[model samples]
Structures are given as structure tokens and as C-alpha cells.
Target: MYRYRITAEIRRDLERIELLRERFDNRGTLPRRWLGRLRRDLEAESVAASTMMEGVRVTVEEVRRLLAGDTPPTVDELSASLVLGYRDAMSYVLRRADEPSFAWHAELVKAIHDRVMGGAFGLDAGRFRTIPVFISDGSDGEPVYTPPAEDLVPDLVDGLAEYLESSKELPAPVVAAFAHVRLAGIHPFKDGNGRTARVVAALAMYRGGYRAPEFTSLEEWWGGHRGEYHTAFDCLGKRWKDSSDVTPFVAAHVAAQRIQADALSLRLATQREIWTAIEDRVE
Candidate 1:
């Protein structure tokens, strides 16, 4: 069997259902200003993330060109335009490819970090090490685990993959929650594990028929609640270290998803209102 780790397809499905519930609850009463502002914010975030990952070489006009169905530039061309090295640019393009699901394993996380940070951070892209890695603002710290020494990783990943494949029929929110917590507990990479886990969670949700996983910024949300996020992960990690039961992690995942859903609902309502106003002006 293909071993997998921390796949959360079911949890993401549930999130979509909940989104629908919120939309229905609001009925036709959403305001124009709110809807317009939310749409603009969402679009702005998308552009910012794309630029951050892709680099500064590609201008807004170039991005618009690509989005307008123009022939997409090659990785090398994009890199030259974005002022990034050839490999870094290629890696960014590959990660955002339509085939992102092709690399749904823990190893892929390291690969992505290395690709993104190789020249920028002078990191060795070939090997996984146990060095300490931290994010900006002194948050997101953890001792790294090299694969062979960290024997639990492979098994944990396999279990996660099995869970995902077996529970393919579950809701997206539940699946996303499952994938997020399991990956977070495993803490697979020396760096970028959280970001990678979030990406995987988003991918799981996307594959399960939800829109792109960029709706609510989990990173932005978790960054604001760093202490609580870490505490929840630590709680689950301790349980996994002792009993191997994932209930605690699952609970945390559900709670986080609900928070995200609530935020998304508010944004969606706001966007609906804004769009209505824009439409009225056009008329």
C-alpha cells in the first residue's frame, strides 16, 4: 500500500457544507459595502501571496496577462522577470501547478522548503537535518527530526494516509481538520512544516470539491493565536507520544476549522454586499 501521512480530505468537505449553511442563513440580506470590501480583500491577499511566492520580477501587469489567458511564461522566463534565481522560480511554479497533489507526502514538504529557501537561506536542498528552525517574530519553533532517527514519522504518515484513503467519504471540514492536526503533530520537516501542513490541508479541501484553499488565511489566523495553537498541538503531540490516539488532535482540528468557517462566513457576507453595490452602480 502507498504509505500516506496526515491526509485530511473529509474535514475540508464539512467546511464547505458549513459555508453553505452560513450563506443560506444570511439569505438575501447581505449588504453591498460588506460584499465589495470582502471581495477586494480576498483578491488582494491572493495577489500578495502570489507575488511573495513568485518574487518581485513579475509585474502586476504580467500577472494580469497570465490570468487573462495569455500564454503562460516558462519558469525561467518568470524567474528572470521576477528577479528570482532560475531554480527558485521553477520551484514556485511547480508547487502551484495543477498537479500539486502529485507530491502529497512528508518528503515533499522538505523539498518545497529547500526549493523556496535554497539560495535565499543558503540551505542544503539535498538532505533533511535536525537543526532548530524558527519563523519570524520568534514564533513557530521546534527541534527538527531527521527521518531515520525519527522512526515515528514514517508510521505516522502511513497511518494518516490510510485514514484519508479509508475515510474518503467524510466531510471536507472533518478531512481538513484530520489532515491539519496529524501533520502538525508529526512535525515532519526541520522547517516550513506548519506552512506545508496548511498547504496540504488546503489541497485536501480543494480536491474534495471546495474552492481554492486560499479563502481564509490559516497562517494569519494561527499567527494571531500562536500560544493557543502551540498548546493545542503540544497536547496532541503528548497524547501521540503516549497512547497514539488521535482524538485530541482531531478535536483541535475541528475547533480550528470552526473558527475559520466563522471568519469566512463574515467575509462572504461582506463580499456579497459589496458586489451588490457595484452591480447597482453599473446599472
Candidate 2:
């Protein structure tokens, strides 16, 4: 469906992600107490960061509290609902990370959008758009990119599904990065396309074995460096353009993966240090 040249940086970053993944996975024998703590912490962080990127107004504190079953912040109703929906969707992705039978398809894409826009306004959950949509600058409201026609949405998605199945020889991170850029470029749904695209990227990383999917926080990295993130997508333009070389976008994605892997390794070590301090004090 799309074509890209894998540059040397892409190869190097992909290799780094895999190496860091192996180093971190060896710590899987972690004490259950710490593992559960880290899992809960990372889940809330992922929800907060991912939703915030999509313009959700809630804070990380509010989201963390919400995940703990507390009442939401006194923000707008949509903010709370959007974050909740995103949390559910992120949880679903993490759950499916290790499934050998999992494959990308149109129905699965619809389902993710459903989770993301379940209670939002002026949008149909889990369905492709029937009209044109333009993504614009948040500041000026000038259109930055125009998606393909509504009539082409279905076929575009079908092409992506086919590509995901056939690209087995490509590096998983590269495949996942392309999947994300294509999904967002297709802009298939009326809403939740961005959130859904990010989740799809996470699914690709998990499927590719880049790192333990449970704890990798690529969203966290993306949210922090959104300028680079948006620029990466913009560098490719939409799928139909003559300048749609995906090498830069894939390179940026692999860079984010490398950052997340290193961050996870350091966090894991820090958690262990804290646990040891507690053990020493108790003894």
C-alpha cells in the first residue's frame, strides 16, 4: 500500500530497541510486589499522556485518580469520558500484545475507535467517516492535511490490512511505524483517528517484540516530543503525494522506541533500588 526506504538510522535504532528489550526482559523475575506497582503506575501514565495528546483537558493527577476509581476532576464531561475511553483502549492493547494469533484488520481498527470515542459528541463510534475530514493546526485552524475522500476510506483501510499481513519480513518497529503513518494519513474515521493510530503503533511494537509491551511507554515519549512527532508525519504528507517517502517518519519512530526502551530500563533499575532500600531498612 505504501513504499519506504529503510535508512541506516532506522536499522541502528531498531537494533538498539531490541537489545534494550533483552536487557530489560531478563528482569522479569522481579518480585511480584514491584511488578504490580510499576504496571499500575505505567498504565495511568500512558492513559494521561495519550489522551492529553488528543486534546483531553484532564491532568495526569486526575487521570491517575480516575484509574484508581476515584471521582474525576471537575473538568468538562467530555474530558472525563475521553480519558476513560482511552484508558480502556490502552488496556486492551496491552492485553493483546503477546497474542500470537493477533493480526491487524479493519474490524479491529473500528473496535479501537469505538473504545476511544464511545461517549464523545458528533461522531459515530467504530465506523469510518462518510464525509471528508481535514486536520488543521490547533492554533490557527488552517487545514494542514486533507484526508482522502470518504468513498476511498474502506479500500484504503483494506490495503493497510493486507500490508500488515504481508510485511512479515520487515522489522516490526518499521512495520508498526508505517502502519501508524498510513492510518493517520488515511484518516479513516471521523474522530479518534489520531488516538487509534497511536494505539495501532503500540500494537505493532508489541507484535514485533521491540520490548515488553506491557511497560513500554512510546506515548509518553511522543507526548513529550510532539513537535518532532507531528513533523515526522508531516514529512511524509498523505499517501497520494509524490513526496511520501516514509524513511524519516520511520526513523523518528525508531528513535522514540529507543528512548522508551532506555527510559524503561532506568525506571526498572530505580524501582529495584527503592525496593532494596525498603528491604534494608526493614531488616
Candidate 3:
């Protein structure tokens, strides 16, 4: 299992998340319809960013179009498939997040990958790799990290599921972070590992009661801060070793959540002002 401690800073960040979550839950005067629109926007942004991280060149606008069942002329077939596939996967995660019977298992993980990569290309959809896979350095295509052999993937994924099941005591953010890093490290599927890992992390947060709209937006942050996102995985080393402390990666995940919460706070304040002004005008 990945080792991490909830440091003082992380604890403080979690407090901030709690505060912001409270604000989201208690919307004061913001209308539910307005929140619905914001949620859709977040969904589009998330789909675009998560797919883009895997080198898909779809924009948020394109994603919105695809979600609306309209295809942009400029979006290639591959990009369209990638965007829509991810949108479906995120939708699946959102639906399952609140289910009381949800369990972390190899099938759930595979199902997420299936939704993400099912028809995007001819690539293997939900099955673990039958051969070796390597993470390449972006520019030169040189191998950077070697995932565990194909034989170990099924057991490793099962172990991950067990860990998630038993990690209920940990904070949601920590569990989310660990899931993200571990899945990425495991590279269980032949492709879509990063996307699957992110979706799994989002599921963790949602199940832990962080299902507010703003919580779904971290993939946008990760999309923009790709360098930091990849660097955070340094704790995993060049292989799937269990010895390294993943505190830094967990800290980074918490920080991302905090940042998103702060952004949402500002947006909420602005919206509240607008709402107040409209009320005064109507009065």
C-alpha cells in the first residue's frame, strides 16, 4: 500500500475543503438552475481537459458540442470519439458515485476504462495488457517508467481494490490521491491509464461526500498543470515499488482540491452579488 501522512498543512487544507463544501451545500440565494448550468460547464471542461491530457486535441467548446449531440466540423473523428467517450465515462462515475452499493473492484476499474477507451480507437478497451507497457518521455519517446509485468497486473489491481475498500478511515482527498497515483503507477490497462485513474479518483471524492460541482473540476487543473501533475508521480520511482513515501503526491492532490474550492468560493461570491443586485432591481 502507498504510505502517506495527513500533515498539518493537509489537515488545514481539508478544513478549507470542508468550509467550501459547506458553502456549496448552503447556496444561500443562488438558484438551482444556475447551479445546473455551472455543473454542465464543469462537465464540459472536465471532459476536454482529461482527454487532452492523453494528447487528444479537443477543446471545451468541441466537448460541449459533442455532449449536445452536435459535432464540430473541425473535430476529427478520433478527437470526437475521445471527447464523447470521456464524457460518457465521467457521467458513469457521477451516477455511481452516490450509489450505496458501489464497490471498488477490478470490474469497476475495467468498466471505467471501457467507457473511456471503448471506441476511441482500435486499442484494447477494458482488458489489462497482455504484454509490457512503458511510459515514455514526451519528446524523445524514451522509456521513463516500466510498469509491472503483465502477469502481475490482475493481482495488483485486485490489491488496489482491496486497499480502496479498507481505506474508508482516510480522508477522501487522500484516498483520491492514492487512487490516482497508484492506478497511474500500475498502468493496468494497455492505454487510458491516466484517464481511468483520474476518473477513479473523482469517484473516490464523490463517494466521500465531495460530490459538489466544483469538485469535478480538478481534471481541468491537472490538464493545465501537466508538468506538476507528472512530477508529483516522482515518488513512484521508475517502477512499482512500495517503499517510497507518497506524501508529496497526496499533498499535491489536496492542494488541487483547495485551489478549486477557493476558485469556486470566488465565483460564488460574484454570483451572490449579481443575485442580490437583481433582487434589488426587482424589488
Residue 19 in model 1: lDDT: 70
Candidate with maximal TM-score: 3
In TM-score terms, candidate 3 sits at 0.94
The positional error of residue 206 in candidate 3, measured at the CA in angstroms, is 0.8
lDDT (tens digit, per residue) of candidate 2 on 98-150:
77788778988888888888545466888899988888878998888888889
User: lDDT of each model, Cα atoms only?
Assistant: 0.50, 0.79, 0.85
Model 2 lDDT vs. the true structure?
A: 0.79
The candidate that wins on lDDT is 3
TM-score against native, each model: 0.56, 0.92, 0.94
Pitting candidate 2 against candidate 3, the one with the higher TM-score is 3
The number of clashing residue pairs in model 3 is: 0
RMSD of 1: 8.6
Residue 185, model 2: lDDT of 84
Q: C-alpha displacement of 132 in model 1, angstroms?
A: 9.0
CA shift of 54, model 2, Å: 1.1
User: How many residue pairs collide in each prediction?
Assistant: 32, 0, 0
Order of quality (TM-score)? 3, 2, 1
